[model samples]
Target: MSFLGFQLRWNSVLLGALVTAAVLNDVPPSYEALVVLAPVIWADRTTLTWVRIRRR
Candidate 1:
């Protein structure tokens, strides 16, 4: 799979796990921050991918 595909799958799993943890622990800000940051990190990865693809 491509980098983005792997990232997407990983993010999905991470998100689920984090969400479950948050639910079980009453949604702490750290976990909430992680949950929010996942997408931002993914967006950065996506931007990097485009740059790499374009450079090829």
Candidate 2:
């Protein structure tokens, strides 16, 4: 799989786990931050991918 594919799969799994943890556990920030952080990680990955491609 490509980097993107791996990231996508990993992201999906992480998102699900985060959501589940947020609902099941008592830690507020953990789940809330994970919910918020998913997009940031995705955007950063996208930007990095493009930057790497441009350098090639």
- Counting clashing residue pairs in each candidate, in order, gives 0, 0
Model 1 accuracy (lDDT, Cα): 0.58
What RMSD does each model have against the real structure? 8.2, 8.7
- Give the Å error, residue 37, model 2: 3.2
- TM-score (C-alpha) between model 1 and the true structure: 0.40
lDDT by residue (1-56, candidate 1, tens digit) is: 23443334455556567668888989654966777866755754322242224444
Best by lDDT: 1
Give the clashing residue pairs of candidate 1, or none.
none
Q: How does candidate 2 score on lDDT?
A: 0.57
**Can you give the lDDT of residue 49 in candidate 1?**
43
Which runs in model 1 stand beyond 4 Å of their true positions? 1-8, 31-36, 39-41, 44-56
lDDT of 1 at 6: 31
